[model samples]
Target: MKKLMLMLVSAAALTAHSAMAKDTLTISVYSFAQDAYKKALYDPFEEICDCELVIETGNSVERMAKIEANAADPVIDMAVISSHDALSLAQKGLIAPLDISKLSNHAKLYPAAQDPIGNNMAVGYTFYASSIVYRDDLVKIKSWGDLLGKDLAGQVSLPNITGTQGPLTLMMLDKALNGGSGDFSSVIAKIGEDADDIVTFYSRSSELAQLMNQEEVIAAPLGRFAWSRFKNSPLSFAWAEPEEGQAGGMNVMIMTKGNGNEELAYKLMDYWLSTEVQTRIAEALIDSPANKDVVVSDEVADNLTYGADLINSLNILSPAEIIANRDAWVEQWNAEVIK
Candidate 1:
């Protein structure tokens, strides 16, 4: 009958449509600002590539563990993590070197961001300046030494040794106390001596911000990326510029080893690092742009760690140094600072 013939044709069309759906591109990233990322980058990328964007979010360590566990069959097609974390993955052969030629926007990145880890395993996506965040009404943080000073005793929170901010904090504290010799033992000892005075050693910036908002703490060292939480708050807060200078670090994008999705992955990465997308992300205050061509309004710039001058001024820690010293640093930290 004519009705049966029409039904058969409709069924065939549905099957063909289902078969023609685009492939999925999986990405692992930090658990911060996903909503803004969705609006500014992910949705647009998915549309352009005609692929489903599968996002997995967590802290760096957990995501790294996931990639390592699934090494034989990668669950994540691509990722964005701290440069040091990416390097760690590279050393273990857990990630693949990016083909710069595939990323059309790769040439627009700052020279420092172009090959931060040097193995082509990753490329920088954003930079952050680290320093103290203090309640302006309650504390006067003139130097990194102020964290251990008697004035803010029992009212300060320090980043834990396991986190990125922790080592940067130690670096500044080392400079403050020992004139930047790169040895943080004395700095750890000083914190150990003042252990009881410190409110807690926080792992997440959000945790630090919460404590400050509740008045449980007056000051804590944090990354510029997290400044918006406190800056927008009803309570007064200030980002301190210490005599030792601010510490800086970069986050990078990488491809998981043998994920079998290189072309689509590169397409997404390229789009994410392009001037147009980077500018939008900067405008949303989700990240400080790594693409040098991105220009934003001053009002938007105020919320970001923008400009080459400030980036150059930062006392950046080398990813190699962090990797080489981290284990020993954590061991020393637990024995001294936590004891």
Candidate 2:
């Protein structure tokens, strides 16, 4: 009787361990705001799904390279990346089309978020407007053209051509100079012409913020997501409403091609897109909600890229356009601007 009872207990332990292993879900995401995300999104979703989230965090380029390296056997079940990066993955057949039927919150998303990168391969979870953030006390910025103007010349900084905001700044500057010409050769040459007057090409928003705070840079183009850094600063800063308008972009969520974890991944994605979670994230000021149903207070909205009017009014460069012309842009930037 003793031997039989011990055998039963051992088998039960093995079954419990197997269940725990099967319930785990792995994900990759940006390195920023992990603590805020845990409090707002990760912790709540973990409770609802009853699964452990094994998260991998890094820059989009590093994370995307990892996904590509492990394409034969995906380590990340799902990931959040810039829309252009998602499109690049979709083009490479590294990610699978989402089963929208499985997502209960699918209908809650803004139309632009629903099929951002077509074929349901990815869904946008956030949008951010890009514009110039200037020290209003020191100088006035009325146009994207002003960054290269003689007044702000030596005091202005621009994003590097390799960063996400790089192409956006280029697009807006092109609009300001030539009235929305898609070709950027002349734009690149123009920037090259004024490169000597420009302070430096910053790779991260934080670096630009630091430069501004020290009075080294008086004005620079930045994404709204980083507005809080300047908004709370002791220095007087202002967001620009340039004549060319605010340029914007979206970040998206994607499922790996064959991770064998769709059930749990879809569950988390649905919960994330739901109004409750989206509102929580927006309230935390971590990301602007892509779900149209999310409502936030005026104070909270001021810190985010919120509301239909502003979202609709943004001049967004398409993911297709970014991917198609990025190489040429970079090549010219190296030869002319950076040289």
TM-score of each: 0.94, 0.92
* lDDT of each candidate versus the true structure: 0.90, 0.91
Count of backbone clashes, every candidate in sequence: 0, 0
Residue 222 error, candidate 2, Å:
1.6
Q: List the residue pairs that clash in candidate 1.
A: none
Distance (Å) between predicted and true CA of 89, model 1? 1.0
TM-score, predicted candidate 1 vs. hidden true structure: 0.94
lDDT of 2 by residue, 1-339 (tens): 999999999999999988777488999987667888999988888888778999898766789999999999999999998899899999999999999999999888999999999999999899999999999999998999999899988999999987778889999998998898988889899999999988999877778888999999999999887787788899999999998899999988999999999999999999899999999999988889999999999999988999889999999989999999999999999999989
lDDT of 2 at 148: 87
Q: Candidate 2: what lDDT?
A: 0.91
* Candidate with best TM-score: 1
lDDT per residue, candidate 1, 28-66, as tens digits? 987777888999999988778778999998777789999
lDDT at 21, model 2:
70
